[model samples]
Target chain A: MKKDVPYFDKVHRWGRIWTLLALVALFSVPLVFSLAHDAWPEPGPFLKGLVAILPLYWVSGIIETFTYTPMIGAGGTYLSFVTGNIANLKLPCAIAALEKADVKGTSDEGEVISTIAIASSAITTTVIIAAGVLLFSIPVQWLTKSPVFAPAFQQIFPAMFGALMASYLRKHWKTAAATVLIGCIVVFFSPSIGIGILIVVTIVAAVLTSFLFYKISTKKSAAK
Target chain B: MDFKSNWLMYLLAAGVIGFVVVESLFFLVKAWKRGKELGISKQTLVNTVTNSAIYSVAPAISILATVFVLANALGNVLPWIRLSVIGNLQYETVAATSILSELGGSLTEEVTDPAKFAAVAWGMTIGCCLPLILVPIFCKKIHKKVGDVVNKSSSASALADVVAAAAFIGIIAAFVSKSINGIEVTKTLTGENVVSSRAGFLSIATLIVSIVVYLLLDTLATKKHLVKFSNFVMPIAMFTGMGAAVLMTQLLPQSLVLWSWPWLPPVQ
Candidate 1:
């Protein structure tokens, strides 16, 4: 027997219309805000920049939406992809199964586990982001009047980025080394090359090094 | 002065927490009803929803905590650097405040003396994090429903499968809206005295466009290559976004610091 299509798919008139309207309304929000605002200064360059960033945000959203489910449901994906799959041999499938609700050993138990996992993740994310936005941004303004405190605090972004990147680098030694080397060599000379160029170039360098390593490893095996 | 004055932020957080509790209860109820219909014990449904809700939020919390640490730290650091760069830069404060206002609600500057700016800062940070807190809760509800369907049938129907996908998209749209609104309000209302409000508008517009272009190129390149390699690009997209955000913050680096500091608390 053929699989039956879902009721939701079968053109529920109200839901379809509402979803469509929501899409349209949401898409128009930024546009409407843009039009209503006064003539922006040197609007050309700035508007260009905002336009440039929109797709990145959009894509980030798309990736984020999917990535969380998988990650929460399955622990091993990160384990295998990040580390060289040492101790976490069974985890990737387990986590994936958990998220996809295809848990092994028992079907009933698996469904319960996966469903709860997704719900809790959603709740947690919403709460933290909202709280973070309010709690952190406020003190930022108060410090502006202070002479000593304000400047001391400003290094957070670079520091955080540095810390995050550092952890990743520590995990993958050669690629990280090569990326830093390339970034520093190029960006040091051309400070104006901007962060985007620095990132793109560094990622390319890392990928190249990975390729070279792969080639070397295969050749060594063949020689053996 | 009173808690009532700050009730909005509290209310927002409370609403989110409430949603999680209520949603979990609703799922449990549905699960029980379904189980009864299928002749399973109500206890099974309760156990299932309770377990599912708890498990789902753990990772979401982890990710949120990571973001909070980064964002709050950034908020703290931005102002100091911005001030150091442009010392006593006469009342760029208005520009900064306007930007904050454009982003969402106006700075409580007028009501709270600029001397108490720190307190106001605290308030805004709490308020801004409300959405981050709320959206994830909804994710769990959707997850539970999906779990139900999957349990009843051997596999999830396409529609059920897509609910998470759809909800995730909605969350993204909400985020973008929040960001854009912030920029426009900051530029239009708060920064009005400095230059044309349009300046902020136009500049943010350009920045957004650039990010989109960069992402498109990055995504297309990923699609053409090894699947694993392509997947790696998602984090790169986030990295690019941070780079873009940092760049924008640089424009009025002080404003970026002021508003963002609370969001990026120190991780360790």
Candidate 2:
């Protein structure tokens, strides 16, 4: 909402196709090579390794967008709308690139933040892909002795996810605590119910927390 | 049928279990209080959670199940079936990762290629992130609908509103956790150590550094003695903390990042 922030019209005007193309161009680097070097001694192992890591890369991209944005500005406003959108859109890699180039746009802060956000995204993306390969793909390769690929890909999704959740909990400790406590209790008692317990617990916790907040606020008003 | 990999499945199952229970309680409490305050029947709250969870989750679950089934079918029939459904995108991902690992390894590896590695790495750049990107667009609609529901309430709508939002979130969490047990399960298995030890170390280091940084920034923001700038500290701290995860990823090797490994009974 900042006056200096670039209008959404200008930034998003390129459309989703542009976003997709950017993403494709970003991802196609290796595919082109694989095609060119078709006989590169069983692309399976390498390909499998990459697939195993897809989850990590994906999650990191999201996290990087989050990291780079000044989501919490002085008065709870984002520094720049462009940076905010990229962060919200969960597309930090491209955001970072846009920043690096200092793409022409509205607002000095938006440009600055976007640049930082993009750089941050690029760095995190690299880390995510690397970690996925090492943790998921490498071990699988070592064990399977085949390009059959290890379930490392699965690992990537969870690692990024769990880390993200953990961070969220850290941010809103009270909500997280409530969520976890209720979740554990239900699971402990009704072991066979699968996710039903979560539904019950979540409802219970949220209502209770809200009620508590209301009570506190009313009490303060009374005193005033 | 393979037991070795079954550990992963068991891990997933347990996670769904936890995710469901906790999420349920959160929503139930939220809806119950809100409904009561609004003079609506308690059942309405329960129904809201149940209905929302079922509505949003079923499709994604089916899609996942179908994918799994299809994979198995192809794998069984082909035996050596390497379905090139998505082209050779795999090679690019691996090559990119290897190159990144090498690049992050240190400055010594100069002969290494950059463009090839960048391309390969780019394959995974958006992995599970596609959902995050998509979810917001969808969530906006849900938020608006819920806002309308809450706004219809006659009493202290603020409190009722929070409860309603919380209920929606709970329902969504329950449904998503069930549909995507894989994420939670992996976390649980890896979490025992990751949360307690690895995250612990990182958290501590971050806390200390954040305090120092806070103090330094505090001088700048408070130099004029206005509490206005001082409020920036929390956001700054939050931004820094969020960024720190990526920073650690950059600094540590992949193996070192996953330093948590708590022991649990083997899944039968």
Candidate 3:
């Protein structure tokens, strides 16, 4: 926030402070609940539960940070991860905004677009969800759970990625083909593949294939 | 009703959820102001906000539906807190279910023990906190290094774009393959493992239908020049695909698909 500080530097400074606050806020819910009700977790059950879930989610957390941080930019990464729904809502929405603007995601213009779009998505979702809980809980609950709507809820991922994948594949088939092929091979071996591992493997494959394709296309052009 | 639904529980959830709201607003304002200073038109920035909001409507509604399901065990406030923060339906459900099981509690049953309830909340909390912690420490460094590498040459810059697109393709590919292959990820030692899978022909049908409708919408927007209507294309295509799901469930029979898992019914 200092006048001499650059915008990018300022973002990191404030982002660290806010992120630390958010982390504390995240843990406070249960801590306060225990204090208010005089209810404490029995150490054995708590450790058992923690042991089962922590390693996998944490490893993916590590993977998600590395993979998505570069793509979404610093500001986008800070906001989107906190607001959650990175893959489904935040990442796709930011990429789509960048696509619409015809800017590269690595550009400064791309950072502004991604941050604005992700922040908007986060606020909009929070408002809608808050409204649902406070004002329209009954109708919202019934409507979403109704037979007519249940299938839609369960199948949201396929519904979302169908178009998104098509749009990306159309423009970047050279890289897309490589990644998708690798992803399928992995899936064939393990039908229910861990998303973090899948992303890591396919991304590595993509880098190699794209380099190969890039070299070939350039060589052909030079010869011509 | 259990202790999870008490008035104090709602207050605690609101406090945490409120923090997220404030965090979002703080970033939204900062970005909006930065966009203006960068000489990006106000109209363009406004369009981004509105268009992004329109895209969010479907996903938010679907998320609320998941909240209702989670509410059965942990009550309304806890699900609201978890979902509004860094957790999703699948992750939250699995975390809470396993934690309850450790305490000899059932997620399908109303939790009466305050200690067990507190444990579930703690479990969900610790599982998702890594992102928030890791981001603050590492995000600035990662962003800058990646940007610096990309700027080294025109070819490097171009490769950056391909790499980003490839990341998206990598994720979507896993999802598409899951639908085509019959794979259901129940929580396991690693938080996700495939215990059962059905012949997921029904999901394949939905995926195809969605792709077709989206293409049609793209045609309408680009070929027909429906500029104003373009904003609704993604959401419209999404809902239409949902309609396909309903139709497929009603008309498509389990017997019709080869290797179909007999238990993978249309709905829970």
Candidate 4:
């Protein structure tokens, strides 16, 4: 355990180093393209495009860091942010890994498991997308054009969420019930609400509900 | 150089993908070695790798669908690189379309000019790059703060878990809510009120089927005490639900099976 302490510290040191490196690499994609083509983005339209999605991404990115960091732990958080696909792929995979390993997210074991899961998923997704790109014309065309495949692809979100909800809702019924009710009303009425805003709203509702539930239960026990 | 599809563009995209692969593998190996040191069994580590990889396939394929969709407009290489990196189908499509439309162009038509293509690509890369930049800066501090709160009391830890669970529930609920949009009634051209969302109905049906499958398999896994089976229930349920969605589309009326709805905006 004493030795393991340095391991985590080392992870943080290395994680930050690797993340900074990856950041430079990612930014260089556009930079390289612009240099290679000798064509820079037009300022007016680029700013307009940036403005359109900037607020949403900025808000969501900040909110997600807060919301997901505790759930996935340190190493997982660093890898997942770089790898992307948090809500849909990485989070669920981490949770599943932790559950399978019988580890708590706050524990050292949990951090390691979550990181392994996320890293593996990231690799798988990247490799598959790369393959899809290489085979663009025939396989991709068939997958998109085939009538049998279209409906299955379209319902991916629902299928994913349904399984995820079933696993999670069993233990946190109170929180699940409250947030689901609120989420449903929001989605049904204001369908235009983006996923980022919806996530923030849900987090607030969950925290408040949990606090209220804790208070009520404590009061009941005190009365007893 | 053709702005649409060029060998140079493919090489550039490959470079980005190659970098991601190397980075991902680096962390994966580091984490795996650390897990072993932490006394996590080799079997547990193997299961994590296998299950996560298997679970990723369906979603990865769906992402491929997005790549194809965007390929028509932005060309294959750029969309491939974007989707493989931090960008999802929704964000990339929206960012590209927003920039293209603002520049007096449409996604349906390819951006022939190199400048316009660069603008859209740069817009997406910049807009979505926040998470990568922000996470490294704040993750350690955030984890320490949360860990402090959780360690303060047993009740606090419980509350924290509940909060996490609730967040997950809320996200799932939002997705499920959109799935039921087909049940909503709206006025039609013939003055006959009808359900306006065939696609929604399909989604809802798929959700229900998947949930049932997940629950049933989970029950069986628990009863049988099958540890491996437990790890796989979600992916199994998702595939089942997706198959059911395809079947539902065939059985249901064509008018009810929509490709897109007003409430659930298209990626474009």
Candidate 5:
């Protein structure tokens, strides 16, 4: 079957429009606040604040854009970037959906499934957070204070990733093993390594290793 | 005007969150229709939606907890709005605290001054907004490059799959390692050594349980030919792992304290 070139092009067009508008809308919050309160941030402290986080977050953001965009596909990329929480929520959800549907990220079916999954996850997260905020008194208190539930909340990342890793490894054991070995070495030896930097390095290493392995195996098969 | 926890601030927050919801709904409808046109069954699409929704709850609640922490520092509405939009728990907390400390104020205290509050709101908004702008500008280019490489031949397409799998596995491994290895030791006032990494241990335990649960469920689903069960397995494994973590915490020794990241919301 031929690719849906026009459909993807349309998605990119609409994605650009929505995200640019989102950028404007997001900045407007602080702008409107300053105007309404008749108060602008002091130049010194504001610059100081920006300088502190700008370097790290900017680099991380740039790295993430390159690393995640291809994996998430066109529609999923657009929506996940806007809604945020890429690593924690949207990425995992999208990957699980793709895996369940048995679709490759490079395929048209993969693109559609990823988009649907990410959109649904974003909507669900927004509604849940909104409800949690609006009904904060009892829910927040219980969530934070209930001793029985505290560990569950604390261990959330591990639990979510564990399930995801199992499924992923079952399909791609060689790549998963190599990645985990590198990850373990970095994490164990230098505990202070930043998570963002760790992710970038591991990805580079995994891709290089996988490509080499694929080349050698293909060469052997051809020789045979 | 009082800037701390004002009704006007809440109204502003509500407006931003409303825009996000509308935008998400627009994309959701578009994607759903596209999937239908592509011959994906309605049941599959609905299952994706349901699965994603269920998968989102635990993480959403975690984000909500961070909102409560930020509410204590920056007031209710700003954190509410910040988190509802492009902000995550770790980045916002770190940004707010860093900005607050720069101004000689702490995030543990409320920001009553409008100027300081604006500084924080702007600092967070701008610092995190880079990706939103960059993604739109460069996502198409990146996608095009990937598509070109993958479309070359069958071998190239398989290589691209390997690359994607590698990236995902590498990222997941980093996270898992961090959870397991993020340990610390501190001395008490009485000079007793306290191994303060119960949280890490709990997470390790959770990871084990989740993996086991997922494998068992996956096997059962395959045997029974239950496609829906496969779709729902992630959330189920997560919940089971979380339940096990809770049990471990209750039964674990007191000397081993469960330490959260410094930026995480404090247990109140």
Candidate 6:
């Protein structure tokens, strides 16, 4: 709490340091594993794999960073990107925490809440995965693959997004509904459309829908 | 060299996981302090943490399912480290398969050769390393620009909220649409790519069940003023919806829809 420096500035400074540390830590895993095993990669196949995948991976990476950083706030972005599971886990957790705290993403309070929420989610996921690896690898693997628990696990996306849609749509039906309709139409026709384009299309529609609703409400009030 | 579940590999995985856990704790405590400084109540922050943890449970289990699949060929330590850190199930499989295929091996086959195993590890790491390198460089500038737009006007702020809500709706629509259109090629967490038939009806049913349960919870918690019910809304809704999925599979005709995702095996 440096009284002189703005909170955002402090957060950025801390975020950058931690992010760099994370990078070092992550890169070292492969580096050290290769060293310890006395097994360096064969460059021919490695580069071939890299060539096949890096282009698309980098493109999605750039897109996600540009789109998701601001939405989740700074600290949350730093942690979520490192922890992985953005769309499925961190983003939703941060959004729910924001809604619960009743703070806008742009607010200072919102930044803290999003950070706390994301950090908590990351830690919990880490611990759970660690435990799964350590204790019950055999049982957990069998259980997840079991027919009875399989469907429940398979529907995680629906279970999550459905709850989110119900909450957001109930509040902003006009905007959310229009966006969902357009998204469904496009996605149904071509289910392979990347999420990047879907988000761009829906954002444009949602903003326009909101503007249209405001105009209609204003005209009605003026007439009255 | 046997690359499967060696002590050294387990130690390395634990080290990476441990480092990340500490990083998360650092952020958590720092942000918790920052919230106090910003005049938020301790109770609210605690509740947010609690709720976020609860919200993460189901998805975390699903992630573990992915780990299991990857571990089949690559061994436990590699998949554990990859998925725990930055390698998502999708990207990890794609990267691993790319390298394995390039090496004239398949994901179903284990890498008895340590050099090939190390190559696969490098493939997974480097493919997903872009954001790790790029975010720290560019995120601050992006965040500031967004804040400028958000703080520009009252109307702008309102639009920003719409933007966030739209993200949610858009993704849900994409997911549910996959189910509705009913001919999606989905990658199971088990690393199998298969064409799903009648999954649309099942997903749509689950989505609707989730929505209805959420509505019921909302009505009870908010309008009916059952304040205690508020905290459990998300977890409760998600679990019930999942339960409904299993039930729908049992009740629906097997010809039309069965509890047959991983059960249907692979059409690919």
Candidate with top TM-score is 6
Candidate 3 collision pairs: none
Per-chain TM-score of chain A in candidate 5 equals: 0.92
Tens-digit lDDT track of model 4 for B57-82: 98898788778777777888888888
Q: For candidate 3, lDDT tens digit of each residue in B36-127? A: 88788776788788878888887998887778777777778899989988889778877887788889877777888889989999999999
lDDT of 6 at A224: 100
Model 2 reaches what TM-score against the true structure?
0.33
Give the TM-score, chain B only, in order for the candidates. Answer: 0.32, 0.27, 0.84, 0.83, 0.86, 0.88
lDDT of 1: 0.33
User: Tens digits of per-residue lDDT for model 1 on A1-224?
Assistant: 98875322321222233233323332232223223332122334333433433343334333333334332232111111111111111122122223223233123344334333333333333444345444643443344324443222222222222322322332345644555555545533453342323333544565566556556766898999
lDDT of each: 0.33, 0.33, 0.77, 0.76, 0.80, 0.78
Instruction: List candidate 6 segments past 4 Å from native.
Output: A1-3, A194-197, A218-224, B182-193, B196-198, B258-268
RMSD after CA superposition, every candidate:
17.6, 19.0, 3.2, 4.9, 4.7, 3.1
In model 5, where do residues sit more than 4 Å from their true spots?
Answer: A1-5, B183-200, B252-268
Positional deviation of B5 in candidate 5, in angstroms?
2.8
Candidate 6 local lDDT, B173-245, one digit each (tens): 5555545443445455344666644445678788888888988898888987875568668777888989988
Whichever of 1 and 4 has more DockQ, that candidate is 4
Q: Which stretches of candidate 1 lie over 4 Å from their true place?
A: A1-25, A28-129, A132-137, A143-153, A157-171, B1-268
Model 4, position B83: C-alpha lDDT score: 81
lDDT of 5 by residue, A1-224 (tens): 97657988989998999899888878988898898888787889778878988996798899989888988879999888888888878989988888888888778888888888888888888887788877764677587668888878878878998998889878777877777777767766666566677878788878887787788888999999
For A102-192, candidate 4 gives per-residue lDDT tens digits of: 7777777877888888989999999888887786557876876699887787788788888877776666677767777777777667765
RMSD in angstroms between candidate 6 and the native structure over all alpha carbons: 3.1
DockQ of each model vs. true complex: 0.04, 0.07, 0.64, 0.59, 0.65, 0.64
Cand 4, B chain, TM: 0.83
RMSD of 2: 19.0
- Provide the TM-score for each candidate, comma-separated: 0.31, 0.33, 0.90, 0.88, 0.91, 0.92
Which digits, one per residue and each the tens of the lDDT, describe model 6 over residues A1-224?
73798778877888889888878877787788788878888888779878998987888888888777877878898888889988778988887788777787778898999999999999999998989988988888887878878788888777887877777767777766677777677765666565555665665666677667767876898999
